[model samples]
Target: MAQEELKSINFMGWRKTIGAISILLLLVSIVSLAVNGLRLGLDFTGGTQIEVGFAEPANLGEIRTLLVEQGLENPTAVYFGSETEVLIRTQGAMQDGALVLIGNRLEALEPGAQIVRVERPAAGQAGLSQVIVLDGVSAAQVRDTDIFDRTYFGNVEFAQVEDGLAVTLENSLDVAYTNRLLTALSEHANTDVELRRSEFVGPQIGEELRDEGGLGMLVALFLVMLYIAFRFQYKFALGAVAALIHDVILVLGFFSLFQLDFDLTVLAAVLAVIGYSLNDTIVVFDRIRENFRLVRRGSPKEVVNFSLTQTLERTLITSLTTLLVLVMLFLFGGELINNFATALIVGVLVGTYSSIYVSANTLLALHIDREDLIPPPKEGEEQEELVP
Candidate 1:
C-alpha cells in the first residue's frame, strides 16, 4: 500500500471545533446520567431478577400491571432476553415468597405462560441439530420444546437447574438466605429449582469490584505506557496513555453521570475499549514515525496531520461499520443488551476521537521525533513495514 503523501491540515485551527464537540458530548453524557439514569444490571447493583415465560407474547405494560395486581408493587417488567419470557426484578427483596405466588398467578391468568423455551438441540456437534429444549429439558425432549423457539442461549437463567428456570434474586448477595428462599420457592411452586444464575454484589462486594476495576484500569494504562515507551518513545507512550485515559474517563463519566450500573461486564468493556483506542493510536503513531523518517522537512504537527488524513478513510470505514452494527443492537437487540450496546456505542465514539485528536495532539505537546519513535533500521529487520 502506498503511504499517503504528507498534507498539512490546519489542526490548531480546528481545536475550538473539536473542543466544542467534546464539551457537547460531555454535557449530553452528563444529562443521560442525570435524567435517563443508567439501567445498571444485576452484576452491579445487587438485586433479584425473575424470568417467567408466558405461552403468549409478553406485553410489558400488562406484565407490570399484572405484577401490581399480584401485589408486586413497582416490579420492573422487561422482556426477557429470549423466549416468550419476561424478567421482573425487585430490590432488597423482602418478597421472595410472593414472586412464586405471583408466578403461579400469572400462569393462571395466562394459562399459556409456560417456562420460556430456549434450548438448542445439538445436531451432530453434540447429539442432534438445533434440538431446542424447554428452559432445561433434555435433548430428547427438545422437539417437544422447539414447537415455538426463536433465539440463542435459550431462556435458561445462567447456571439455573432444569427442574425450573432460576431467577436472579440478588447479585453478590447473602447466598444462604437466598438459597433458602430458592428452596422454599422450589417446594412452594412444586418446581425443581437450581441456583442457575445469581449476581449479588453486597455493598462490600460492589465496592471491592469498583475499587479493583479502577485499579486494574490504572495498571493497564501504566503497563501500556511502559510497553510503548520501550517500543517507541516515552513521548509516544505518554500520548497513547493520555488518549487511553481520555477514553476511560469519558466512558466512566457517562456511566456515573447516568448512574448506570458499573458492573463487571461494563468494566470489561471499558478495558477493552482502552485497548481498542490504543490500537488505533498505535496505528496513527506508526504512520507518523514512518513519515518522519521518510520526510525530514515537516514538523511533528504536520506529520500528525498527514498521518491522520492518510488513515482518515480507513478509520471512518471501520468505525462506521462498527457503529452501524452497534446501532442495530441498541435499537432491536432488546433490553438485556441495552447497556452493553450502550457502553459500546459510547466507547466507540470516544475512542475514535481520542485516537486521532487526543493521542496525536498529546504527542505533539511532547516534541516526539522519528528516532525516539522508530529508531533507524536495525541489522536485519529492513525497517519493519509501518502499518498501511
Candidate 2:
C-alpha cells in the first residue's frame, strides 16, 4: 500500500504572521462595534413590520423616502420576497391610524401598490368571529369587527357566497387596528386591497428577546467547552473553545463593521458558527491525538502539521460544498433570508481558518506533550490477580 501524497505546505511555519493578521482584524472589529454599532432590526428594537405588494415592481428607495415624508419614524423599505413585494419596518410602536397613513402613502407612490399584509408579535389565542352583510356599504360603514380585524381567516370568499355581502369572520381583530389600513387604501384610492396578515409586539418583548438571544449564545459556548474537555484533554478543550470563540468574534466583527442588520436570525447563525468551528477543531484534534499514540517520535508542532495535512482535503471539501450552497442562497434566496445566508457564508470561511490556525496553534502554545494525549504505563505496574 502506498501512503497518499500530500502538499508539503508548511501551515505552522506562518503561524505568527496569521496570528498577527487575525489579532489586527479582531481589534478593528471591536473598534467598529464600539463606534458604529450594529443596525438593529424590528425584531430587536420593537416595531411594526408591514408587508405590502405591488401589481408590478415598485421602487424601494422611493417608498422609503415617501414614508419618511409622511412623518413616519425611521422607515425602512426593502424587497421582501420579490421585486413586486416590499416589507416596511418602522421604529417604535406605530401611532394611531399609522397603518392607514402608510397605506395612503404607498398608494400615492405607486397606484398599484397596496397593503397586502401586516404582521405584529402575537399576543395569544385572542381574535374575533362574526358574520355580517351590508348593502351599498363602504368599508367605513362597517362596524369595528367587520373589517381587517383578523390575522387569519377560515374563509374569506366573496365569489362563493353572493347577494349583497356575506362575511364569516373567525379569530378577527378590532377594525380600528387592521381594518382601517384596508379602508384607507380602498377609500382614498378606490383600490381593492387584500388583508394578508397583522399582529402586534411591544418593546418589552423585544428587550426580552434580545436578552434571551445573548444568553443562548453564552450557553452554547459553555456547553461546547464542557463537552470537549470531557471527551479529550483539558488542553484540547481549551484549543477547541478558543477556536470557536475566534470564529464567533470574526463573524460578529463582520456584521458590526458592515453595520448589517443584527437580528435574531443572525444571532442563530452565530451559534451555528460555533458548532461548525468546534466540529472542525475536534476533527483535527482527534487526528493529532491518534498520531501521538501511533507515531511516537516528533515534537507537538510536527504532529500538528501532520494531523492538519491528513485532514486538509476533508476540511476543504466540506467547507467548499457548504459555501457553494450558501452562495446560491445569498444570490437567489430573496431578501427574506439574505442576511442569514450571508452570516453562514462568512462563518464557514472563518471557521475553517480558525480550525487550522487558532485551534492547532493553541495546542502548540500549551506545550501539549505526548503524555498529555496518550498516558504512559505506570512504573513497576503489577499484573492484576486472575479469579480462577
Candidate 3:
C-alpha cells in the first residue's frame, strides 16, 4: 500500500496569534512561580518518614489523627505499596528527649513492659553499624516485623539471638521511641502494628538537594545550547534553546499555580521534558535546513511553513503516543508517581506547542535564510566553483 502525501497547511499564517498566546502564557507562568513558588515535598524539605504495617488494611484518616494527637505537626499519611502499609511524613526532626518521653508514656500504659536495647554490628553487612534488641517484647507483639521493615532492612534477618528479640537497625534511631509508637498503634486498633522503617532527613541536606537540582537544570540547558550551535547554526541553536526554556517555564508555572508537590521525581520529570522538547525542536530545525537548500523560490517564512507541514504528522503522532502513556501513569501509577506523571503531561503538551511555534517564530524573527546554513568553501576550492 502507498502512503498518502500530506498537503501543506500554511502553519506560519497564524504565527502572530500563536506568538501572542505563547508570550501571554509565559508571562503568567513566570508570575505564578515568583508569587506562589513550588510546594516542596519531604525529599526537598527535610523531615521524618515513618512506615508502619497493620495486620489489616489501614485507615489513613485515623492514622493521621493519631499522629496529630501524638504531637507530630502536619502529619501526612498515605498508603505505600499496599493498603495494609502506610507511610507517614512530618516536617520536623525527632527531638533529643523524644524517646525518653515516649518510654515514660508507654510505661504508664503498660506497667512492667520494659524497653531494653543491646547494640551490635549487623551480621554479614559491615556497612550497617547498629542493631537494637527489645528485651521483653513477645513475638506476637512484634508480629510481621520483618515484612514491615523490608524497605529499609533489605535482606537482613531478625531473630531471637539471645533472650531478647534482635532486630537490626538500618539507622541509629532510639529503640524505645519505635516500640512506644508501635504499642500505641496496636492498642488503638487492637491489631498487631509493626514499625517498618523510620528515617530522618535534615533541613540542611534538603536545601543542598534543592540548590543542586536548580544548578543541574541550568547546566543541562547550557550544554544543550552548545550542542545545537555546533550541529546547526547559531540562529537554530538560539531558537531551540528558546523553545526549551519556554517548555520548562510553563511546566514549572503549572506546578506552582496548582501548588503541586514538587519533589525529586518531579524534578526528574522536568529534566526529561527538556530533553523531549529539544528532540522535537531539533527535528523541525533539521527539516528546515534541508528545505532551505532544496526549495529555490520561497521566502524564509514560506520555507518554514513547508518544512513544518512535512513533519506535522510525525510530530503529532509522537506526542500523542507519549501523552497516552503519561495520562495512564497519572491516573493509575499511584500516589508516589502522580506528581511525576503530571509534570511530564504538562511538559509534553507545552513542548509540542513550543517546538512548533516558539522555535519557528524565533527563526523568522532572527531573519534566518539559506545563506546562514550554507557551508564555507574548502581552503583550496574556488568560490566560483561552489553551487549557490
Candidate 4:
C-alpha cells in the first residue's frame, strides 16, 4: 500500500535531467583536477610544521618577513587558535641548517656563547648530546636571554653538569629542530615565544603515503564492487560502483577547485563518503529488488520510481542529521580540523546526491528488469512461485 502511494510520483521521470547535470559536474571536476590539481598538505608533501605561542598577539606579516629574511623559502604563517598563536609551514627539512643558524645567532648575542655537540655512546642509536658553554658570560646572563625559556626547547631538559650546562635531547632530530626554530624566532622577534609543537615529514615518506593512499582507495572500490555483485547482481554492483566513483571524484574535484589542502584526513573522509553513499545506494537497490519481485503489473521504470519515493524520506532524514553534526564540527572544531570537517561536509552532500541520481540512473541505463532480479524456480518447483 505504501508502494502504491509512492508510485504516484515519477522519480525516474527526471533521470535524463539529473544525468545531464551529473555529467556536467563530473566534467568540470575532472578538468579542474587535471588543471589546478589538489593542494597537497604537509602530510603528503615533505615539510616542517611549527606552532608557537607568543606572550602577546603575534603579527603574521612581521613573522613572515622575518622568516623570509632568514632565508627560509616559501614560509607560510597563519594564526593557529588565537591571535597569540601562530602555525608556520615550510618546504623541505631545515633542521640541520636551522641549528647552525641558531648557533651562530647565539654566539652573536653573547660574545662567548657556544653550543657544543657531544656524540652519543651507541653507534646505531640516533641524536646527539648538546651543551652550552658560557665561556665569557655567567649562567645568569644566559638565563636572562629570551632563548633560555624551557618551552623554547621541546622534550629537552637543561641541567648544570660539572663542565657546563648540559642539555639532554630526546626524540632525536625533532627536539633539536624545534629548539633551533624557537631560538631563531625568539632572537628575531625579540619576544617570549613558546614552542607549542613541531612536525617534520620527509619527502620520500610523503610520496609513499600519497601513492599508498591512492592505491588503498582503488582497492576499496574494487572490493566494494565485488561485494555488491555477490550480494545482489552484476547490474547492481556496476551501478553502486559507478555512484561511489562519482562521489569520490566529485569530492576530490571540490578540493582541487577550491585549492584546499588534501591531507590524510581528507583522504579518510573521502573513503567514509564512499561507504556512506554505498549504504544509501544499497538501501534503495534493496527496495527496488523487493518491489521487482512483489509488485505486479508495473514496468521497470515505474518500479524504480516507486522504490525511490518509498526510501526518499529515510535517505533525507539520515543525511540531514549527519550533516548537522558535520556543520557544527566545521564551525567550532578549530583550525587543526577545519579541513577535515570541510571534506566530510562536502562528501556527505555529494554522496547523498550520487546515491539518489547517479546510482539509480545507472541501473535504468543498464536496462534493469524484473527478470534480472527474480531468481529462476528450482528444478521440479512450481512456476507460479516465480510469477510477479
Candidate 5:
C-alpha cells in the first residue's frame, strides 16, 4: 500500500529564516568559488606525462633527482601505495625531449632495475584563442575569413620529424616531431598496459567538450523549468530554476576554489547533480501543493513550514541512504572514482539543503496564494464538501 501522506506542519512560520538560509547557502557557494579555485585535472590542460613501474621497488627521491638532472626541471613524482609504482608529470615545454632524458636517467640511476618504455599522448593541433563567443550575428559580420557561417577554425601544430608530416589527419598537418614518440592507439588496442592512464586533452577538445556539455546542461535546465512551470505556476517554476542554479553555482564554487579538474566527466557529474537536486525540490513542492489544498486557514509560510517538517524524515532518510553508498565508493573505489564520488557527496548535501531550505522557501517568497492553488468550492466549504 502507498504510504499515507504525513500531516502538514505550519509551513509559513519561519519562512523569512528559511529564505535567509537559502541565501546563506548561496553565499557559502560564492565564497568557495572565490577562495578555493577548482583544480583542473590534466584531462582539460594539455601536457605530456610518463609513468614507469619498476620490478624492484626503488627510491622516490633518487628517481626525482635523476629526473631533475635529465632537464625536467621540477618534476612531480607521486607514489601510488608503493615505491615501485610512480606517476611523473613534466611540462609541455620541450616535453618530447624530457621523455627521452627521463628514460636514459632512470637507466643510469637504477642499473639493475628494469626500465619500462614510456608512453606519450597525442598533441592537439588546434587552439581556442581564435574562437569567439558571439551574440547575434548579422549578415555584415561575415568577412573574407568566413566569420559568420563558420565560427570555429582548426589548425594543427605539427611535430618536427626527420621526415616531414609523419602523422596525418584530414585538413590538419602533423605536429613538428621532437623525440616524443606519441601514442599509437592502433598499435596498442585491447592489450592492457601496467601503467594506468591519465589524459591531458588539448584545448581544442576541451573547448568542444565544454561548449557542447554547457549547451546540453542549459537545454536540460530549460526543459526542467518548462515542465515545472506547466505543472504549477510561473513563479513556482522560476523559484525551482533559481534553486537549481544556486546548487550548480555552489558546486562550481567548490571545484573552482579547490582547483578541481573540470573535465567532461566532472561536467557529467554536475548535470546529474542538477537533476537529482530538482527531483528533491519537486518532491517538496508536490507536498506543499497538496497542503495548500487541504488547509485554507494557515498562511503560505505556515503551510510551507508544516510541509517541510512532515517531509523532513523522508528527505533525510533518502539523503543518508545515498550518502552511505557514496561514502563507501569514495573510501574504497580507488583513485579513478575519487573525484566523481566526491562530487556526488557534495551534491547530495547541497540537494538536501535546496530541497528543505531552498524550494519550500521559494514558494513562500513567491507569495503563492492557496486560493489560486485550491479550486473554489461549489457553494460549500472544504470540510462540508469532503463529508458524505
Candidate 6:
C-alpha cells in the first residue's frame, strides 16, 4: 500500500552524469589539496602570542605597523575580544635580548651633581664589562647609572624626551617581549595598554598537535564504519563510509584551495561533518532497506530512486536549517572561530550532497537487493511447519 501511494523520481536516470561530475569534483579537490595545501595557524606553527587591551578602541593596522617596525617578523595583529582589544602574534628575535633600546640622555642636572660616564668592573666570575662612569659620586651611585651594564645587554634607561620620559628596555625572545612592545607603543600611540595574556607554543608541541589531529580523524572514521556495519549490511556500511570520506576530502579541498587556516577547531568541525553526513546517509539507507522488502517487484535502481524521492523533503529541510545556523556563525562569530565556522559551513553543504548522491550511487554500484538485507530462513524449518 505504501509503495503504491509513493511517487517515484528518476534519481538513477542521470546516474552516469552525476557520477562523472562527482568524480571530477573529487579529482579537482584532490589536486587542490596536493598543490595548495592548507594555511596552518599559530596553533600549528610555533610562535609567541600576546593579548592586550588599549585605553581606547585599537587600530589593528597601526599596531601591526608598530610591531613590524620594532623588528618583530611576520607579526599578525587582530582584534581579540572587542574593538578595544588586540592580539599580536609573531616570531621574535633569533637571539635572546638582541634588540636594545637606548633612551635620550638626561640634560638637566643638580647644581652639585654632574652628568658623567662611569666604569664599574664586571661583577662576579663572568668578568663581563659592567661599565659606569662618574666624576664625584661613589661606586654605588655610579652603579645606579649603569644602564647598559647587565649581561646579555639587558637594562632599562629613563631619560627626558620631547614628549615625556622615554623608556629604554631590552627585547626578550620569549612571549614576554613586553619591554620592547611597551616602549614602541608608548612612542607611537602614547596610549595606556594592559597585557591580558601572553603565551608561547613550542615547535615540538605544535608538531605533536598536528600528528594527533590526523590520528583523531582516522579513529573517528574507523569507529563510524564499525557502527554502521553492525547496524546494517556490509554493502550499506561501505557506501556510507565512502560517502563520509568523500565529504571530508571535498571539504578539506575547499580549505586547501582557499588557503583557509586549518587548526584544531577546524579539525573538530571535520569530525562533526563525518557524523552529520553519516546520519543523513543512514536515513536514506533505512528507507531503501524498507522499500526493498515492500516494493519487491522493481529493480534496485527503481527502489533506490523511490526511496530518495520519498525522503527528499526531509533532507532539504534538515540541510537548510543547519546551513542557516552555520551562516550566522560564520558571519558573527569573530576571528577566533571564523575558520571553524567556515569549515562547518562548507562541510555541511558537501555532506548533504554526498549523502544524497554519493552514498546512493555507491549502493547502486554494489547492486544492493532485497536478498542483501534479509537473512535466509532456517533450512527445512518452513517446510516442517507447513507439514505440521
lDDT of 1: 0.63
The C-alpha stretches of model 6 lying farther than 4 A from their native spots are 1-6, 71-74, 91-153, 156-171, 379-383
lDDT of 5: 0.61
In model 6, what lDDT does residue 67 have? 77
| lDDT tens digits, residue span 295-345, model 1 | 776766677788788888878888899899989998998876677788888
Task: Give each model's whole-structure lDDT.
Answer: 0.63, 0.71, 0.80, 0.79, 0.61, 0.73
TM-score of each: 0.63, 0.73, 0.75, 0.73, 0.62, 0.78
What would the per-residue lDDT of candidate 6 be over residues 1-388, giving only the tens digit for each residue? Answer: 4446656888888888988998998998999988888777777777678888788888778888877666665677878879888887775332222232211122222233333432334345142333322233333433455333334346534444333333333322232346546656755767888878878777778788989998988888888888878888888889998999899998898988888878789988999999899889999999999988888567888889889999889999999999999999888887778889998988888888888799999999998888998877899989999994
Candidate 1 regions exceeding 4 Å error are 1-5, 16-40, 65-75, 95-201, 258-261, 374-388
Per-candidate clash tally: 28, 7, 0, 0, 39, 6
Model 6 quality (TM-score)? 0.78
Native-referenced Cα lDDT, model 2: 0.71
Q: After superposition, how far is residue 227 of candidate 3 from its true place, in Å?
A: 0.4
Worst 10 residues of 2 by lDDT: 152-161
Ranking, lDDT, top scorer first: 3, 4, 6, 2, 1, 5
Off by over 4 Å in 3: 1-7, 96-184, 187-190, 383-388
lDDT of 2 by residue, 1-388 (tens): 1123323357899999998998898898888878988887778888777776566666766666666654556767778667766676777654434445535644554464444333332355244344444334334333333333344343332312243444444533234334444444344434454545444567888899999998988888888888988888889888888888788888888998988888888888888888888888889889988877766656667777888999999999999999999999999887778889999999999999999999998888888888887665675544433333
Give stretches of model 2 more than 4 Å off.
1-7, 96-195, 376-388
TM-score of 3: 0.75
| TM-score: the better of candidates 5 and 6 | 6
| Model 2 RMSD, rounded to 1 decimal | 10.8
* Candidate No. with top TM-score: 6
Clashing pairs in 4: none
Give the C-alpha lDDT of model 4.
0.79
lDDT of 5 by residue, 1-388 (tens): 1123434554556657877776776787787766675555545444545564555664667656655654553445656656566576554433344334533543454443222322232466333222121222222322332211121123322233332222122221112112121222112222222445543446566567667887998999899999998897777798788888878887787777666656556777889899888988888888878888886676676667777887789889999999999999989775556778878888889888888767767766667877667554676676796798
Residue 52 in candidate 1, Cα distance off native in Å:
1.6
C-alpha lDDT (0 to 100) for residue 80 of candidate 4:
84
| Candidate with maximal lDDT | 3
- What is candidate 4's lDDT per residue for 77-170, written digit by digit as tens? 8888798899988776665444555566677778766666543423542443444433334456556564444464444545665666655544
- Candidate 2's displacement at residue 283, Å, is 0.9
